[model samples]
Target: MLLVYFLLWVIFNGSFTLEICVFGLVIAGVLLGFSCRFMDYSLAKERKIYRHIFGFCGYCVLLVKEIVKANFGAMHLILTQREEIEPVLVTFHSDLKTQVGKVLLANAITLTPGTITVTLEDSEYRVHCLDRDLAEGLNESEFARYIRKLEEEKQVRKG
Candidate 1:
């Protein structure tokens, strides 16, 4: 999946320098070769990876929108005499059970504004949020469930 992304990106935004293109293609081929062994290009695996990439892309778009809203929220708080800011740390346990899922959770947390994943101890995630509302929302559910499900979905296709 990563190899496919690199190849497409190079093709789309390639600078048209033959030497650079050659280097990039070679690197992409090598990475693809290595990943293919692990990825085991079965139909189910391929479908799962495709779905994950699509979902991640969609998640990223939503995250961008949330970031814009958070920016506005932050700005409003800054402009107002009232303090809407309430820094807090929240912890929650999850069932991701894989490094990939944990990494995705960390990344998704980072992608959302005003929230940062501070640690992953076992299945527990310690998140630092800029305010109480974000903290409360985060604490209310297993926000990383989708990421965990994505990882588990792939594990079923493992060779």
Candidate 2:
């Protein structure tokens, strides 16, 4: 965190000198100490974040891929199969343990082109799909799986 703070300080200042470096180091130290004292920040949390960084990056890549695929699917439905379009509302339950995981799942569904999360209460998700095909496998999607994996990683660390 100190390194990140110092880098940000240098970047924002637009120039670096010996005096500036010394000042930035002191400021970064102060900020890091303040966070540790007031914000419950610790090196353990930082290590945990570092461990999950790759998983988060993979999830992001998967999200982009899903978004692109959904875009094409939506386009095809709009351009060639407009007459057969059937919008549907589907409800499904997820086993994701954390609120963050559930919210991420909901947002990922909504971010796709052909689907929107109508409601998310507890573990149940109500999503509106542009077509029935889009609703297929909606309950156990890759998004949900990735989020479950992330949640499991947290549990594993705790255990």
Candidate 3:
């Protein structure tokens, strides 16, 4: 995981020789210093991050589909004779067992049009939607379920 993090850091930072050397020393020092804290605590964080990046690949495809659908839905509503719009706020519990997972869920909600995650308390997320149909779709199922599964799979793989 540290290697992956360092590689990603190097890639993003242009992989400069000086920067890589500097980052290598810094990362080594930090890992050694914090080794006690991570001992027996598991590599959940590493797994979560690894899966999170891969998760984005799937999400990118899903996002395109969702965005197109949302655009058409919004377009239909606007072009058709819809006078009284029923905006709604939907509250639901997230299945994400970690803070990182919760954040991912919130970001997913906000990225999709007509839906915004207003707040997340512990595991509960309060999301605002543009209409009842949108609210209904979200309330019926927590999207975090998918994220949770991915995170879980990551943890298992690390084992």
Candidate 4:
């Protein structure tokens, strides 16, 4: 955090001198102290955030891949199986513990091409799928897996 603050100070100042560097160091230290004292910020929390950054990036990549795959699947269903399409409503319970995890799962489902989350109440999710095939394995999806991993990481930290 101090390093980040110092970098920001240097970037904003546009020029660096010995005097400026000393002042920037002092300012960054003061800001870091203030954050630690009053804002509940700590090095441990910063490290945890840094660790989650890679996991979040991986989840984002998986989301984009799923979106593209779903788009093709939906397109195929619409073009070739329109008359035989079997739309379904799927209700499933998830084991994710955090509200944020549940919400993330719900939003990820809704973001997919052939599925939309109709309701998310407690641990239960009701999803409307464009076809039965899309509804299959709605509960134990990769999105849910990623979210569960995130939830577990938090739990591990707490324990």
> lDDT of each model, Cα atoms only?
0.69, 0.94, 0.72, 0.92
Question: What lDDT score is found at residue 145 in candidate 1?
Answer: 53
List ranges where model 1 is wrong by over 4 Å: 1-51, 139-143, 155-159
The clash numbers for all candidates, in the given order, read: 0, 0, 0, 0
Tens digits of per-residue lDDT, candidate 2, 1-159, equal: 888999999999999999899999999999999999999998788887888889999999999999999999999999994567899999999999999999999999999999999999999999999999999998799999999988998899889
Per residue, candidate 1 scores C-alpha lDDT tens digits across 1-159 of 555756775787756677767777777676766777776654466776676777677656755776687778767656778755788888887667787667767776766777889998787889998777777755333436556555666677574
- Write model 4 residue lDDT over 16-86, tens digit each, in one string: 99988999999999999999999999999899789888888988899999999999998999889356888
Candidate ordering by lDDT (highest first): 2, 4, 3, 1
Q: Give the per-residue Cα lDDT of candidate 3 at 145.
A: 61
Candidate 1: worst 10 consecutive residues by lDDT?
137-146
Please give the lDDT score for candidate 3: 0.72
Report the candidate with higher TM-score, 1 versus 3: 3
Best by TM-score: 2
lDDT of 3 by residue, 1-159 (tens): 456556666777775798686877688557744763766433665665675677777766666777778778877766788887788888887666778767877887787777889998998889988878777756334455676677787688768
Candidate 2 global lDDT: 0.94
> Model 2 residue 111 lDDT?
99
